[model samples]
Target: MNTEPEQVSLNDLAGLPSMATLVLTVNNRHARRILADLSAMLDAQRQVMALPDIMPVSAWLRQAGDQWSFASDNGLAAHTVDAFGALSLWRQVIIEAETDHALLDVGNAASLAQEADRLLSEWQLEVPPALQTDEYRRFMVWRKAYRQRLHDMDAEDGVLGFERVYQAIVDGKLHFDFQNLVLVGFNEYSPRLRGVIDALRAQGVAIFALQPSQVDAAQVERVQAADPDTEWRLAARWAQSCLRANPEGRYAIVAARLENDVALAHRVLREALGADGTAPAVPYNIAVARPLADWPLVRAALCWLRVLRAFLLHGRCEPSLAGAALLSGGCAAHVVEAPAGEQMWLT
Candidate 1:
C-alpha cells in the first residue's frame, strides 16, 4: 500500500465519479469559490448528474460522527459540545479557579486558555514541566478543572470529538460509505486528523490531494501611495475600469487588513464606485465580519435592555440610562408616554 497520499490537480476532479466526496480545509468563502468553479466545469461538460459531496472539514466530521454513532454502540456522539458551549465551559472553569483575586479580563483569558488547550490536543504535546511560571501554574490548574468539568458533564469539545472518531476508525469500529475522498486546500493537518486519514486510506479508500494547476506567472505591479486612503481609492478606480471593460465579468478586490479597516475601505470603494452617501448599489461586494455588539441595532437593543434592568432593580430608571435608550431610537412613543407608576417592563 502506498503510504503517501496521491496528488491530483484541481482540474482532475472533473474525472472523479459522482460518488466521490471532496473535503476542504478552507474557510466558507474559498469553499464556495471552489464549488462554483467545479459546477461550471461540470456544466461545460454537459454532465447531468448529482455533483460530488463537497464540504468543509467540520461538516464532514459531524457527518462522520453521526455515521459512527449509528454503526457503533458507544455514546460518544451524545456528549459533543459546540464552540460556544466549550467557550462558556472554559470561562466557568476560569471563574471557579479564581480564588485569590478576580481576573483582569475573564473573557480574553478564557479565550486564550481555550486556544492553548486546543493547541496541546491538536499537536498531541505534553505540557512542559521545566518552567513553572505563576501564570502557567494558574493555567494548568484551570485546564485541569476544565477537563474535570467536561468529564462530569460527559461533554467533549471539537478536539476530543476528532480524537474519539479517529480512535473508532483505528479500532475498526467505524466504516465510511464513500470510496473516494478528495482533500483540498489542506497544507497541514493535526496529528489526530492525519491519523484518521491514514486509517481511511488503509481501509481501501482512495485519498487524493487536489493540487493547483501550473500556469504562467501573472504580471506584478507595485504602486506607492501617500496613505491607505489613496491606496484604496486607486484600487477602487482600477476595479471600476475593469468593470467598464468587461461589464459581465466577475472581479475581486482583496484588502489584506480588511477587517481592521472595513469602514475606511467601504467609504473609499463607495465614493470611487460613484455611490457616495447613499445605499451602495455597486457591483462589488465587501465581506467583513464584525462582532454583533459592534452593530448599531444591537447596541440600541442593549441600551434599551440596560434601561429596563435599571428600572426593575431600583423601581426607577436613571436619567442617563433613559436618555441613552431614547437617543438610540429604541424607545417608542408608548414607552415614553407610559405613567411612571404603571410598572412597565420591556417584553
Candidate 2:
C-alpha cells in the first residue's frame, strides 16, 4: 500500500508460452546397459501439484500462512517440493529411433522392417512406422528418404535411456511455467511431432509448433492482417501509453503474464489509476441520459472502476510515469460509473 510506483517486475504474469521438453533414446544394442544406469533413478518419486483459484497467477505462488508450500489437487500425496527440472521430464517422452535414413534402407525397409521390432524391443525403444503396419512401411520409406529427426545427444558416459533423461529434468529443479513450454533442440523429428503439437493446441493448450522456435503462421498472418483477435497490434498501443521506449521489445511470445490471461486483466489498471499523473483528461460530454443522479458509495465505486478503465485499456492511466508518475502520492482511487441502461466511452 505504499505510495511508491509499482515496480516493473511486480506486474502480473498470466499468459505466455513456456519452455519445451525433450525426449531421448539410444541405439538398440545399448538398451540393457542403459537400463541398468537408470535403475538408480527409479527411486526418485513424483510429487503432485495443485491448481488453485483466487491466487495470484499460479497455485504455486500461493503461500500457506507463514510457510511456503502447496498441496496436490489430483489426490496424489504431497511429497518434497518437486524440482522443476525433474517435473518436466514426466511431461515429455524420449524415444531413440535409429537415425539411419539411407536410400538403401528405404528400399529395404519392407525387408528390414521385420528386424526393426526386435532391435527396438531389445533396445527398449519403439520401431516406428509400426512394423507390418501401413505407417511402418510409410515411415520406412520416409526414413530412407524423408527422414524425421529427433534430438537426443549422447550421454557423457554413453548410457542412454529416455526414462533416465526425463528423470534428470525432474531432479534439475529449474524454474518453469507453462510459458516456458517450447519445442526446441529437436530437428529431425519435427515433422512427426508436428502432429503432437496440433493435438495439444486443439485441447486449448498452446504449445510450440512443429517448426519449433517459430511463431504460428496462422496467428502471424491474422495479426499482419489486423484481425481483432490478433492483439499483437495492440501491444504497441499499450506500450506507447505506458511510455515504454521500445514497445515491440516486450512482444516476446513466451512470457509469464500476458494480457490474455483473465487473472492479470485489471491489475495494471488498478495500480496505474490510484497513482497520480497529469494524464490526458477524459473528454467531457454531458450525459443527457444519466441526469447525473446516483447513489453514494455505489457511485463512488463506479468512478473508481472508470479510472481503472484508463489503465486497463491503455496500459497506464498516468499522464507521465517519470513525472508525478502512476501511484505516486498518498491517494486512493474513487470514482463513479454511468447507469446500467446506457454504456459510456472514454475520451
Candidate 3:
C-alpha cells in the first residue's frame, strides 16, 4: 500500500518494513518540501527512532564512492553517447545475416567494428557458428586490443563507467550501511537500476517503492484554423492575455513539444513586446529542459572570451570563435573581421 503524505508521520515511520534508508526520486523543489515536512513531524514527536538517512538516488551513488565530482570521478557522462552508439552498433551486427555486407552500409565503420569487438568480450555470449566468418575474425583482433586498454585504465583508477558501477553493486563490491531501503516516487527504472534493486533484495534488505501516478487530462481546441507559422505566436498571445487578466492565478501552456514550442513562445512573446524585449510581468514555470549547453547568453560570453584571449596572445582569432559568439548572440548577419593589431585589455 502506498503511504499518503499526511499519514506518514515520524511516529508512524517506525512501523514501516524498512526505515533505515529512504531514497526519494523527487525534483529539487518537491524534495525541499518533503524534507521540511519530515523535520516538522520529528520535532512534534520530540523523539527519534532509527532516523533514516534520506537522500536522492544520485546523491546516494556519489556517497557510496565517497566522491562528489560527477565529471572527474565518473566517465558516465562523457561515455553516455558512446555507450548508446555501442548498443546501436551491436543491434546491427547481431541482427544482420551477412556481417560484412551490413558493415558496408554503416556510416562509421570503425566505430561499429570497435563496438562489435567490445560486445564479444563484455557481453559474455557464446559465439554462434553464423558469426564465425572472415569479417568477424578481422574485427576480433581490434576488440582484443581495446579490451586491454580498458583493463589497463581500470588498474590505473580511471573514472568508473556507468555499467561498471551497476555491475559493482550487483557483485556486492559496493554497498551502503543501510540495512533496509525505501524508494519514493520511482515509477520507472532502467535495466541497470533494476539489477541493483534485485541485488539489494537478495541481501535480505527490505525494499519498498512508493510511486504516485500523475496524469494530465487538460485539452486544447484551436478557435481558429491551424496556420503553422502563426499558431504558436497566437497561443503565446492568448497565454499572455490570460496571465495579464488574472495576475494572481497560475496558468500552464501545454504543447506537444514543450522543449521546442516553449522556447519559441518565449522568443515570440519577447519580440512582440518591443526592443526592450519585455513580456507580460507574469511568473512562468516552463516544464521543459534547459540544458546548460543550450544557454545562448553564457555560450556567447564564453566564445567572446576565447576570441579575446586568442587575439591577445596570437595576434589573430579563429573564425569559429567569432562565428559562435555572433550565432549565440543572434547577430550572425553582422559578423565582421577582427581589426588588425587591436589589443584588448581587461582590468
Name the candidate that leads on TM-score.
Answer: 1
C-alpha lDDT of residue 216 in model 2: 55
What's the distance in Å from true for residue 339, model 1? 14
Cα distance off (Å), candidate 1, residue 70: 3.3
Candidate 3 lDDT score at position 35: 56
| Candidate 3: regions farther than 4 A off | 1-19, 26-33, 36-51, 67-150, 154-162, 173-175, 213-231, 241-245, 268-280, 285-337, 341-347
Candidate 2: where is the Cα deviation over 4 Å? 1-133, 140-230, 244-347
Q: 1-347, model 2: which lDDT tens digit per residue?
A: 33111111101111121133211222232333223333433444723222111111112222221021122221112222222222222111111233442343322443344344224433455554445776665545533331111122111110112222223223332223232223323333322233333443444443431222234555442234355333433543444454444423433233233434323323333333233465432111111232232444444444454456556656765443222222222224211223321232223
Model 1 RMSD to the real structure?
Answer: 6.1
Q: Give the worst 10-residue stretch by lDDT in candidate 1.
A: 338-347
| Candidate 1 lDDT, 6-94, residue by residue in tens | 89866676677867566555556657866787777656557764567778887877777777776646567347788877886787788
Model 1 Cα shift for residue 93 (angstroms): 1.2
- Steric clash pairs (candidate 1): none
Which candidate wins on lDDT?
Answer: 1
lDDT of 3 at 261: 69
